[model samples]
Target: MGSDSKQVSKIPKIDLSGLHPSVAGGERWEAAKAEVAAALFSHGCFEAYFPSSSDELREAMFGSALPEMFALPLETKRRLKSDDVYHGYIGQIPHMAYESIAFDDPVSPTAVEEFTKLMWPEGNSSFCKTVEAFAKALHELVEIVQMMIVESLGVEKHYDSLVSSTTYAVRLSEYGVPLNQDTKIALDPHKDPNLVTVVCQSKIDGLEVQTFDGDWVNVDPSPNSLTVMVGQAFQAWSNMRVRAPYHRVRVLGKEKRFSAIFFSRPSHNSMVKSPEELGDEDHPLLFKPFSYTEFVKFLYSEEGRKAKNPFNAYFRIGNEEAA
Candidate 1:
């Protein structure tokens, strides 16, 4: 789909350096909260710059491990393929020229080792170690971002229990740019199924977000900046006050693109619902509470794939309440 115009709107940028424990209650922290709140309200996506130490870990994953893995032969990559979406390599699909590897529990050493062995067969300890280290670092950063979102909404105290059971996964994606300008779509438009997604992209930019006015704007990749997108769970939790933007990738030319995306969701048993404090008569709970497991099942189902908003099944607005 073509944009209404060639002009692209820049996503908001928020510095997260002040999130350190040493300055949790300081001025910088409040400023960060305000910036984050505005971004979440308007775009549902924003750029976040963390400390240098965190950037090093991000670089190791996107700069080192990802390229090394994607450079491997297709035959070797196929060895890690699985029917399941939560783990292993997924081959390219129509309208997209990228192959991706998913690590269900990125922070788990055993899981990483098993995944690495599946790819290398013989051995690749360094790959496993690097990914595990990167995953752990990113996980910690995701938690910090989650807390910031909670604080921005003024529901940190109410949402404290939910944070403890959050689940995470990391995916390494490489998109091949098409030679033909006619081949426009790299990825179809859709909202992420998780609570939030933090994406670190390689220098090339193809990621685009659909604005409220129905225009697609490119989200240019920046050095040491991770892009964050609010998702369906966040929208539900906020009683639809927050939104999940629909985004897609458009390959410009023959250049290749890569990204390491970390998705954080509530645990399987955690209920996805609007916080009571955020709902009132004017805006009653818009979505019915759903368990994370149920949502996942629907997310991957045939019907879910066809629906514009797969999470609409959980909507309390016009639909009968769940028994």
Candidate 2:
């Protein structure tokens, strides 16, 4: 569905440059917190802008490296394939027109090294190095965004600890039209299974978010900004105070679309539950505590695919079956 430019124009834009001083409770911090809170509660999504220097670094790496890697032949790309959903190349599937390669926790040197070998067995160290640098830069930006999200929810105390040990998975996706002109869903509608998802879309627009009233509105691509969507983990952590908006992608026209999506999540063993500060008798823990691993398994399970909100299925208030 084509997005009404007017509707897309109204999506909130959040500048994260001032998030640091705000964390220490600066003047700018209050305004930033209010902006973020309003955006999350009202729209469940917002466009985020980092400092110009950081944006330049991200654009240089993702803007170039992703296109080059996707341009590789099918067989060459398949060399990095794996059955694991968290890692390796996922070739184009039935409803989706995109092919993606996922790298786990790009900030880790060991993880980066292993991923580089798998992606370029023939020894393209330069490409690997470039990706590592990009990952490092992106990770820094993610930390800032995570803090903003946590602080916006009025849980500023947990910001540092929550983000410090979190794991980030980066996926580079390439979306294109089918040769047969068959109607295929570019990306299906689903809520992310992480705390938050930060996506930098290349200048074509195809992303859409489902509004509270059940209408889908297009998230048009904007220059030098990343579209941030709240994920299931955040919903659970906020005890449903924050929503995980369902979103999808569509092919707009002749051009192929590319995006660098970073999924931010807690450590595998970290227990995800609503912050006690956010709960009371009125909203006594809406979700049961669960680990990231349990959550991931549910996301890939049959029940998860069928459930409208997997978080609810797994931890909602007393469905006898879930209990």
Best by TM-score: 1
lDDT of each: 0.74, 0.72
How does model 2 score by TM-score?
A: 0.85
Error of 1 at 214 (Å): 2.0
Error of 1 at 109 (Å): 3.5
Q: Candidate 2 lDDT, tens digit per residue, 52-142?
A: 3255555665577777788888887777754444558887676557798886777787776777676567766666776677666556666
TM-score against native, each model: 0.86, 0.85
Candidate 1 least-lDDT 10 residues: 314-323
TM-score of 1: 0.86
- Looking at model 1, the pairs that clash are none
**Per-residue lDDT of candidate 1, residues 8-81 (tens digit):** 66788888854663345668777887888888888888888865336566567667788889999988887765
In candidate 1, position 249 carries an lDDT of 76
